[model samples]
Every structure is written in C-alpha cells, then in structure tokens.
Target: MTVTDVIDRVSFMDFEPATASFRDDVLAGLSHPIRRIPCKYLYDAAGAALFERICELPEYYPTRTELAMLQRLGPEIAALAGPEAQVVEFGTGDGRKSRLLLNALDRPASYVSIDISRDQLIREAAALALDMPQIEVMAVCGDYTQQTLSLPTVGRRRVGFFPGSTIGNLTPVAATAFLARCANMLPGGAMLVGVDIPKDIAVLEAAYNDSAGVTAAFSLNLLARINRELGGTFDLSGFRHYAYFNEDQSKIEIFLISQREQRAAVAGRFFHFRAGERIHIEDSYKLAPATFQNMARAAGFEPTQVWVDPDGLFSLHWLLAPL
Candidate 1:
C-alpha cells in the first residue's frame, strides 16, 4: 500500500478527557489538605516535548538503558510472542520501542497504540503505519487508568507492551490493578513490561532531578497548561521543582514547592500554598525483580521470564495471561 493509503487505513480513535474533566480534576486535587495533581496531566503537548528532552539527559538512564535492552532482546521477545501477533502498547510515547519489536516480530499482523497524548499518539501511529505498511495501526487516545480499552480484532495473538519503566509512575496498588486490566484485555496472550529496579539513592534521585533542568521544565509545564487551558493564575516562577528518592518508600517522589506563601487560581477557584509547601506530582516506584513478579502473579499474570541489565539498573519482564 502507498503511504497515503497506509495513513488512510490507520484508524484514529480519540477518547481524550474533556476540558471539564481537567478542570474538575484540578479543582478537586488542589482542594485537598495536601495539594496534589495526577502525573498523567503532565503530558500536554509542551510537557510531552519536554519529556523527550528528559530522555536524552545524561542523568536519565532509564530511557536509553531500556532501549538498549529492547534492541538486544527484541528477537527473543518476538520468538515467544510468535507469528501473526497483535501488539497493543500502553503509553506509546514516541513509538521508538514499538518499532524495534514490530521489526523483529514474525509478520506481525497489527499494532494498537494507546496513549493519553492525542497529538503524539496520532502523529507517531501514522508515521509508524507509513513506515511499516504491511501491519495495520490503530491509534487510541485515552487514559488507560480510567477507562476500559476497546481493541480491534485483527491479529492471531495479542501481546501487550508497556515500556520505558512507565509502570513506576503508578503506586503498587494501582500497578497491580492496571496489570489485572491488561490481563483481562489480553487473555491467553502475553505482556512485555519494562520496570525500573531499585538502586543507589543518588542514581535514582539524579534521574528525576536532571542538571539540565528539563525535568523541572516538564514539571512546571503542568501549571502552564492549566493557565492556558483552564484560566489558571499560577506563577510558575514561584515554584521550584523538587525530587528525591524516598528510601522508606523505595520511590522517587517529585513535587513543585512554593517558594513563598502564595495563592493560585485554577478554574477561577483559589487555593493557598504555604512557603515550602509541595504539590505532589509524581512517584516513580522502583521494584525489585522478585517483588515485581509477585505483584504480576497477584494480578493474574504468570511471570515466566525476566531480563536485567548488567548493572542491574533496569529489568524487562515477560508475563503470560491465562486463557
């Protein structure tokens, strides 16, 4: 098929959360005693671009490390997945890792990319469809955490891909629930997941608090997004990005700390912040391989294989869902 035909054949499904949803979420989250915001909101167009820069930072090793491991393990993963597979990827990002797997898979039949960022999801899915015309591509824009995924029936076997250690973004309870949902979605198939391994405090902390300040920009961009989209009056300069590895939690906790006592309005609703008060934005939980496997088993996935980097910095797991 021609490139135009490939693009035309690519199905685009948008289930993006509405503007009202964003307003409501912001108003409610800010109303809490300890102000907070969901990390998923940090992926507006600008925030997503900022995150791409974060992947290249020297301190951010997860992206590059995971990419390298996928390069080495692609063929093996493809072998286990077998032929005529339908690959459904969660949080598809820039579609870099999916390309590696699709190229290695034996005549893979279709690819479904589910991401919350609509523009990136459409752009990346269309480009992937154009580049790999033999496979069908479906772009889904929705929050997998909040909604049930409706996958198209095309390929023989469905293989789920969740890469870039994105699973770390969810709490343990949420991660297990999310995996259970994936199991329900891909029964009798398998899931290939990228997970971050707990490491030295310094390394984990540095990954989020990069020296180049891209991560900071990414965190602050959420407020900028609220201002542009929801009539928010947030002084981005008044808050500083803060991230640290919480050893007790085995996670990297990220927040935007108010430099001084201040009040900001989001959706015409005002909230006061005390000096040094933090708005919790994200938590990147680092789970050991065995711990993760146990969680997977609890979620109804049989953990069959796991690959760890030489330095034990990252892990890739192969989980099989019962029929």
Candidate 2:
C-alpha cells in the first residue's frame, strides 16, 4: 500500500470554500424553471468510482476512443515528448491512462498529478510509484481550476499531459482561463491536449445517455452525494436521468428530471420542483476543430499537430508555445 515516494509526498488539504457555496447554488438552481447541478461536484470518491464504471460501458465513446488513440500513437507522442521531462497531468484519475504516455517517455524525471479528490490521487500515486520506481510521483490534492500546484523545481522541460478530453467540461471562457493557468505553471515547452471533436447531435446524445443506465446512475449520484455530504434528503427514486444534445449550443446536457412533484430543504432553503421539471446536472460541450484551435490561441498556445480518429469522432490537439 506504500508508494515509492510516500515519504516525499504530502497529504492534500481541501480549500474549496466554494464547494459548499456551489452546493447551495446548485440547490437554488434546481428550484428554478430548469434544474441542474454542476457535474464537477459529482466526483466525491464514490462518484469518481461510478464515473470509472461509466467509462468502461460500451456506449461511452470518449474514454475508449481517447484510450485507443493514445495506445495507437503513444510511442510517437512519447518520442516527441523526449526524456528528462517533468510530466504534469490535470485531473489525474486512475492514472492508468497516463502511464500510457509516461511509459512511452522512457522514464521522465518525475510525474506530478493534480486532482481535486485527495484519496484517489494518493492511492493512484502510491500504486504508480510502486510500478514505476524510476519516476518521482508527486500528488497534489486541489481543484486544478484554481490551486497553487507544486512541482519539481528542476527538469529539462515541463510537458503538460491533459488527456481524457476533460477540458470539454469547461465553458469556453473557463477553458481559456484554465489553459492559461496550466501554461503559467508549466515552463515554456508544449502541452499535449486531448479534445473531443464535434459530431452529430444524435451520436453525441447517445454517448451520454447510454442504454446500460450507467450514465443515468452517474448523473443521479450527485443527489446521493449531497445526502452524504450536506445532510440533504433526496429520494433517488423521485428523479429520472435525462440527457439530450443541444444542437445550437453543440453540448450534451444531462439533467435529473423530477418523476413527480417534490419538495426538499437544503441548508435552511426550501426548494420545489414540478413534475418533469429537470435539474441540469452536467454539460459536455462538443468542440468544433476550428473553435478549439481558436481557444488554444487565446490561451497562448498554437496548434502544432492534431491526431484525429479514423471515424473522426474525436481529436487530440497538440498545442505548443509560440516558437
């Protein structure tokens, strides 16, 4: 259970004052005409595990597609990344997929993984440390959106690995700011980013609303998490998972629809929802290649190369600092 760098690693502290406030905000939002909770709050350990299951589901294309792309081109990416590099991954879940690139790196000096969930990060870090004794494993527990991320002070070049297409979780503005933050933390070098390409609305919707019900369970798990964390009472049976593609917006919106009119009190606030009224739980924006390229430019990155899948259902954009 011990990792190679367990002594060098420090435990993470939760400084998300906004976590509670955001919870209250979501409840308030649910009380309105259209209800929704931010999907980011869905990763409270159990939620993270549920998400891992969802990824394994056949209907979930993003995970498999990205993993396949990585497996196919990993050696090339690793070669381009070179050795003596410091690899920093944003949202380092499971850490299995990252090893694909890390292993290909021929043993980079160290690997720094940042995750909001402390336990998961520590567990993965320990396991990875044991597996790859040559690479230093440093785990930071904090929201990557805004955190003072710590990394090795010395390395040839700091290369950022942002796989999983998780950047789609952010709105365009948030994505811009996020990329800028990552760039600031990384010394001038390159950023290997995975971006999910825009596709047909039907295909996009189907991916989120899988037939196996795993996605639904994932969407509704938020309420279960609320009950566990905030002492809120939510009848899981009372809500239905709803996901649909907003063609104009080019995003898949997942909602928890009230199966029947219900009332709940959270943090001394009374919230009401009519039958069929939906709480917008999550939004995964599908990015057009041009649009995401422009986003990277705004964040001070130039798109040097893009790896698209055979069917072109997704894309991996390799953005680098200006020459």
- Look at candidate 1 and tell me the lDDT of residue 92: 90
Residue lDDT tens for model 2, 1-323: 45334645533344543557666766666666656666668777887887889889877788888888888988788777776788888888888778888877856888888887666778888778778877776777777887866555546778888877888888889999999877677756678988888887777878888888888888788888777776677899999898888778878777888899888766656677789877877778888778888999899887777888998988888777653
Q: TM-score of each candidate? A: 0.97, 0.92
Model 1 per-residue lDDT at 80: 98
Q: lDDT (0-100) at residue 104 of candidate 1? A: 88
Q: Pick the candidate with the highest lDDT.
A: 1
Q: Whole-model lDDT, candidate 1? A: 0.92
| Residue range 81-126, candidate 1, lDDT tens digits | 9999999999999888999989989999999999998778878888
RMSD over all Cα atoms, model 2: 2.4
